[model samples]
Target: MSNLPEARASRNLHKTYEGGSSIVGVLQQYAHDAAPELLRESGVSFGLQNTLDGDPFTEATTPENRRASLLSLAPHTDEIQRFIPLYRHTIHPFVPLLVDIDEFELHVCEYLESRAAGDLRDGSKTLNQWLTGKGINTIAVILATLSCSSYFSDISITERSTTALKFVARAFQALQLANYMLRPSVEAVQTLLLLGNTLQNTGQSDGSWILLGTTIRLAQALGLHAANTKTRGANSRKKEALWSVIVWQDCFLSVCHGRPSGISKAQLKRLNFAAVTGPSLSYFEIMCRVGCLCVDLTEDVPTLKGSVDLVEAIDRCYSNALPHLQSLDKCRNLHQRLEFFALQINMSFTIAVVCRPAMKKLPPGSGEDHYHQFLTTRAKQSLFTTLRTFLAFQALSSMPLRNWSMLHSALTSMLLLSVWEETRHDPQSRDLQERLVGLLLAVSEESSSADTDSDGHPSYYTQWLSPRSIRTLIALQSAIRNTPPLTDHVSPTRSVETLLTTSEGASLHQTGLPVLDSQVPDQITALLGSSVAYDYDQFDWSTVDLSPFAFIDETVNMPFYDSSQSNGFI
Candidate 1:
């Protein structure tokens, strides 16, 4: 046995040993027993044993079997330190052996030495080979690794300083190459999404966006966007794969700072209702883009309108998208996407309202007047109606408390916009005032009907009312009511006083059935009275509060909407 080389000896032992145990089983047993002893004897000096008395078993044969055997033995506390170099050196010559080892082991080996980084590239090539020859564990492993790295970057990057973005970029390129070399796999597209998300989180958004954009192009190239196919046949599978690619691409584009290239009108046309699984995901992407564009209040009206048009385009493509916003189907996922859409619409409406004064001044071109007027009215009314519907839906549906906060912030912002719009036109002001009264009444009714806690107080609105929303509402109201009068550049003291009186009086009388939070009404009054202007160090909220309604003044002191304090909505 010693005269025969190690490979031939192992082969002979396997052929000769005819017990109940298989060759694999016996090898496993031997490796288990020997690995610990080998480690103990070698101590700190063991660096990857490459030749096991060299009859030279195929590189593929020993690494997997030996690695398994070593694992079974559960060597010393320093098992990793001992096995890293050994596994690395042993697997070096065998391309197939690289594919057999698991990703975690690969990661461990890479962590042990920077030089081991080449193993991943080697492993990827091996996987490509395995996928091409006979579809087996390699494809699965590749998909799993991609997903594991994408969703759980902290785990994947445990020992590496590599950013999740760069890792995802590498994974995308690998998957793309694999697709070119092997059969198209849904697993590959899904892995791309995982990589996209990881890249987004790691601030390599540009790289991720470009990768996703390329994926969309690839899908289109493969005829994956064929609209007439929806079943599990070859055409349908291809289409489904392509749809996922497009959705992920859109998401990446929507979230990243700069727009990705390659998405043309033709591509957008392909993504109409017929090609998508549901409009929710695509709508969400459009909403994200809209949000990013409209966050800055000072952006040009045309720019804001461009954002609005993008959302409208989505709405046109997926007509059912808006109606599904309040539908109680798949509540959690539906609510999340709907909430984002709702916020985008509300912000767009605010933009329209802010731009209304400018709209009136634009010189009338042939059809521009009608178009501009329609946009102004339609955008505001649609936003208001949608917001009201959302609130009503929340009141009826057993949504989580966080939903309430979202609804509240939306309502607050809508109210502010309506009031601002009214202030712009006297006739519209009365109509808005009436609507505000009715909304307040509905809120009051809902709050009263809701179950109170042990302390007899309703749940706090913190879960929904993000700080930014609160600040936006305050600033919006401030802007509308305090706008310098057209007659003279007078201080906004009178306007502020009028707003304070009207709001306080409306709350006191429970006008139009307002949603009366006893705390909120008081807080609004106090904030109006106490908040001072930066220019004058004087307390503006003080003079505003010295009314006959002192009780109302004392109660309403806190900031109404926390999010209002920021640079408006985003």
Candidate 2:
């Protein structure tokens, strides 16, 4: 971390300023801080070339054709009008920007007013019509709308999932022509955030993570991260909000995706607190704290410290964060409560991620005393907590939240619980395992029940509840019930680690999910059907102690989608 470009440049610049106490020192620091973004996004000679493969909007040949293609994919004005506000009310709280509700409403009204004047096809024109109407107001209005559809669709809201897809494609089209990263727009920073968000939600987080770097870089170029004082107005409030959003999101996703956060802790201290007030803001601060821990482990582990010190570092950072993890009732409003729950899912999942590697006493290719049993216990504790918390969120949420991060956390817990049941031979473990699986199945059915067809059958999430995951849950229960309790008659020679390919393997062979028949990802099949031999004698780890979430994120476990088949309006 000390040898990274940002740190080194800052060190040299400070030396040039002779202990860095003068105005020249401050200016140099600012220049040093903003250098990464400029080099990354500006695409200067010798810098890394932009790599955005198969991005729909960027593939278009010419500007005219790009607009035409984008126009061809916009969603209905009515659907956008309906779901965007629901998203603002629901998902927005988790990623709150300094937005004026009244102003946004007016923008929607203007688009509606255009359609009310006369319908292009049936009742309203596509969003592209408004874009073509002129003025930059369209970008601001559309990006907010895009935020709704992108996120909602990802959570399997069938009603508008297709609509969100169209809007996302359109947004990137607008971004392409605007030269958004190098130049600026009226809402460039906000637009970049929403764009990355849409990609993240749609299981394209690699691209989303890449886009985040560009967004943070551009935000810095605009001086959006400067310290703020008491006397601030709406514009100042907006910048502060944007800057906060960049830092919180950059750090949060960096942890999940295993990347370096551009903003260091020292850089974090440079920005004053956001010029806003809300219970959501308070929870946002908590998330930032957890994110910093993630950044620490991502950079430090395996390189800066050995396994034992790594466990202690986890304790020092995350355990002391107990006070920050309060009940949802502490929040003032409904949005804050929801956002707080989302934070809980993130924290628990992150802990499981950080502590998982230490669980295996003798992981593949390790020294004699390779494992820490205490860290293994901590991993299981965090994982079960993750399951219960996600179930609680489902029971409480009126509608299934459409955030990708939240869903991945839920899925991570589900997979980990299944793995735990397969390996453990205890009665209490079996009982608790059955209950959790039942709860998850019920939660999935209920959450997906919201968007149904004429026959009252689910439409969207039906596809996400893959046969493999569903059967894995059911097989876990049966495997628990039918497998004989530890008895003298049963002389077991097989190791628990091999149970993955042996126990679940035989069951999966019987269940015959399409993955077995089709070209499903090897990662999932390898996980469920193959077993890596481990010396169970050396490690006192339970089934749940394994790090299933390590390989999974929003993308790995997410069901496949074909954006080209979208139900377009224009």
Candidate 3:
């Protein structure tokens, strides 16, 4: 039992202009106040390189072979048509980008018609012609959808990844030709969202996170974040839905990477557009709420009180959303069931992540510390819920394994459980860890069998375990077998004082957040260090919402997707 250093209160800077009654002083004050907002609102670019209009579309560059390749992969119209239903069932239910399948199907038809007309009289078509006749945005979105849906296709794992990449390349080509960076559209935003998720599914989290910035910028350019009272039609609902997804990704990945989010709290609060109803939309809104709770922890000046308040809000949100889950459980088809489990896992994992910093701050010889004990129990319970729901998701379908969010949620919680001192020896925690290890080993063995079918080549199923995930699994296996302290694996010479002085550690401790201690085991630091965003020791939990549905939107109608009645493929 080491103790954390006292929380550091942040220093605030204020400037006063002399002669404030003078016109010049008042003007200076106003300029200082307005400059930051103007820069942010204008969407100015200070970068030297121009992503848009950098290269001209040429015969050699955007050659006919590119189109030939897209056609070769999906040559027939029916082949392209098949992706719509696949997307509706496999991707849309979770991502919910294409809320109306019929509307998207119409766009698919228009794209095909445009492609047909382009083929009639083209000898080195100009870029504008390519953009106009091909319906570049629509084609990009469709290709992106195919890239994502291919993950759940029945094809071999290798084929699934390769096929998905091919479509992704084609989608990029279409965007490049259309100069999507300059000519932003709702369709282009959808394309980027799908492709970003595809990148994540293929174990490219960094790339996906980078791509999200561009997606959010494009979404903002379209005014998707602003609430519109003039229009309440389907299109407006779609805009609000898309904005929710953007915020969700921004906040979610910010916490995952332990970095500052591009979306500020003011923006998040102002862009509160989760007024829609539907199973997927409701789920999306709640997920965004959970993501928002963790955002404060990752800010440059992390605050314990803010983070703790949000953690409790997250708990309340989970409690609030629970009845929504149970209400839908009356007709729990596979899709609804998966959504239920996914939401539960996401909320719980976020709670655990936010609560982790506080776990390390328990006072020495305070076994009688009821608050600390309750916090520890809450964190452990969250980790357990996350893993259990993850298992439920796996039982329903193997698709969860390929989803990046689900994979990270389960892995992060497991890593926390394995390294936390209190949880390492707990019988129930050990049992869950053992069960998880068994499942991983079983999946690895099945993947090996698939390799045998593939003539000794590595199976795509093996891709689900990224190098980082593999390392985590290996460490967990060793820890379970030996039950040794983490120090046996690696030596730590650094002190908590040294950690507090480092720029990264200091950032976490700024503004009333507790600092990490030197006495924390080296192994635990090594395991959970990267994601240790904030300290969370002191909090009043009495403020937590007691009402089941208090946080849910009252205007939302409870409409859920019943898989039995679905006409699309599942």
Candidate 4:
């Protein structure tokens, strides 16, 4: 699609000032007014008068066709039961959005029973007779769950891909049939979350991001963010749980895209992470804190704009989160440890973003360029930490490849290392870069042997690298091979194995020396796979083109900031 015309005013100025801050719609309107002709050529029709020109809006499917499509897309009740457990195993463990699983199952059983009774009463029945709007919405949620779970099933790659696509199509059609946007429900929001997450995992991040925005809006409409005494009970718990996932997703994706988060800080404050008290914090509670810190680090939008220094923001958030990170170290369960691995990478990646603007050239003969030096060091160290933790995560588990956030973080960190001249050439960063490249190539080769898409190319997720990203990695590897290693390198006295066996929970400084700070937490020690020591007091913490009408894949290696002009870096 053609790029929209550049706005004469700031994009933020386009907010609607009613209901919610509808920035994107207003901006699109601005684009239409400014250059309708250009947009017309790019397949964007302007007015209702142009409906005859084959506008997508004008082409609506009849109710009969819609019912047929939903039926074709939906699997049998037994199949749905099978997929639900797969979803619970693979996706729900990480997200945990669909809290009322028993209720959802009840809905499915009731719908099936009702449909059977209706069919017996009459040989022919309308769509509404078979399923109500709410019923359809329920099925949409089921289909969305199936769409995501299909990848992890023990099916052939071709069958898996086809099945997933069918689920996605059916889920989307069911949502329309249910009029979910017009008459929203808890199930509607759940469906959106499941479908959005499915799209994200399959490399349709742009669509996934857009779907999340809609989910947040619908969630607000349902008053999920409000912590009211009247809204107490199982329903309230479900709302709060769903909202947490929304906050986590909004903050993380916002940081990744270099955009302001849809979930504001005030909204997050209302959730009150402090009230989530327990002797041992569950992964849900832990994830909420991680999400909130991400917002604290990067989501400073309508507030003070450029007045708050990014470095100060990073420090403040990191300081606040140190205690939580420390506490997480005590967790020994395999599940919680996996959660910690995700938290560690997310924290490191978020901090790296705060320092990304500073990843430029240092001034020549400057003794006191701490601002540049500090941030540059942070960006490199954090990016390296992200890659290193991700590597450790992969070694420790096999299912993490299905963890979309980790995969995105790993690919993104590698992309930054490939593009950022400073860390790209740093001797300290080369070993991890080489290791990551080798791992990615191995994954790609593995996928090539078993999983080829319709185009005969390895599926992007299975291959674990986009073509552009892979090329960049190969070039980076070649550069690393040609570059001479630093002559002043010092070998460590203790190997990782010795350290692991000698000390159960030892905190190593950035220099690989064990930290003697009695106050420092063991969690910080085990945060990264590397020996890099970070002081909590000092630092901060925080395309596929498969089809013409398909969503665009994420630019996994794109820079956090679109332009260096904003940060004054050449």
Which stretches in model 4 have alpha-carbon errors above 4 Å? 1-70, 105-130, 226-230, 264-266, 275-280, 296-331, 357-381, 418-422, 425-428, 453-469, 476-570
Ranking by TM-score: 3, 4, 2, 1
How does candidate 1 score on lDDT?
0.37
Clashing pairs in 3: 496-518
lDDT per model, in order?
Answer: 0.37, 0.52, 0.57, 0.57
- Taking all chains together, the TM-score of candidate 4 against the true structure is 0.63
User: How far in Å is the alpha carbon of 521 misplaced in model 1?
Assistant: 21
Per-residue lDDT of model 4, residues 317-396, tens digit only = 44444344434565567666666676678767766766654643444775536566676677678888898888877886
How well is each residue in 1-570 modelled by candidate 2, as lDDT tens digits?
Answer: 111122123221111101245443344467776675443333333332333312344553653554555445444576665567665666665655434556555666665565556532332334334333122224444654665545454444564555555666666656554445544433666767776776666556678789888877777656566654655888777666567677777866776666678776665776564333333335555555445445565464452125446546544444433233456555676555666566677767776766655543345554434345555666677777776677667676733334667766665555555444333444444444445555545555565667676866445434454333444445433333334334423334343334444554565455442112222223232323343332333322333243444434322434343222334100
TM-score of each: 0.36, 0.61, 0.68, 0.63
Model 1, span 178-295: residue lDDT tens: 3322233344544554455444433244555665765555455344554443355664644543464455346324322323344444444444433334544433434333333333
Model 2 bad stretches (over 4 Å): 1-76, 97-103, 110-134, 140-147, 150-159, 225-233, 262-266, 274-281, 302-325, 328-340, 354-380, 398-401, 416-465, 469-502, 505-570
Q: Per-residue lDDT for 321 in model 1?
A: 45
RMSD of each: 19.8, 10.8, 16.5, 15.8
Order of candidate numbers by lDDT, starting with the best: 3, 4, 2, 1
Best by TM-score: 3
Clashes of 1: 36
lDDT, model 1, position 168: 45
Clashing pairs in 2: none
Q: Please give, for residues 180-294, the per-residue lDDT of candidate 3 as tens digits.
A: 7655667778888889888888766678889999988878766677677777888888887777778788777776766678876765675554443333335766776766656
